[model samples]
Target: MGFWDFLKPRSKEHVEACWPGGKMLQVHMEYDTEKTIFTYFGRFGLTFNISKSQLTGAIVKEISRTHSVLQVYSGVDCVGTTDILPTEACNIMKDWLGQY
Candidate 1:
């Protein structure tokens, strides 16, 4: 990502991770009809974009009906971890695999 990219708007969405805490996390991927590429946004401050091939999607382990552990892997290593919506996790994985 470049500095000027910050000033520009791309295809994306903002997912509210915690509304009460005022913490927002974008674990969802929005479809870009123009580019036909799914973009993942969540990283605050500095946004980083890597090769789509590097992503292995997310592993969602359910802890309860409403909770799950979401771990995103880039290659063999985990790039991110958090407990969010399992359904959402599945959607993210689908995007990572370019199935959506």
Candidate 2:
């Protein structure tokens, strides 16, 4: 490893969730000290970045605790929602965002 490696942002982190009917959803996240890029798959295949400024006001809602439906919102727009494991949701909301 090079000395500057420490200054570099972390590599992308990937997580996937599968539904009963063979439907699968995956999230790829790349986070730096300043911002994070979130990529979603399955139904809505789109990728977007959320900076510190936006993350400060971002909202993550647990629509169904039992079903593990988590909704993410930026300002008034509904970015998207996913059905993932409860643990995954917690990690994203707490661990990931907490780093900033």
Q: Which candidate ranks first by lDDT, i.e. highest?
A: 1
lDDT of 2 by residue, 7-70 (tens): 7884544432223222233444444442344433333444444554555333444545543544
Per-residue lDDT of candidate 1, residues 17-42 (tens digit): 22211234444444444444434444
User: Can you give the TM-score per candidate against the true fold?
Assistant: 0.44, 0.41
Candidate 2 clash total? 0
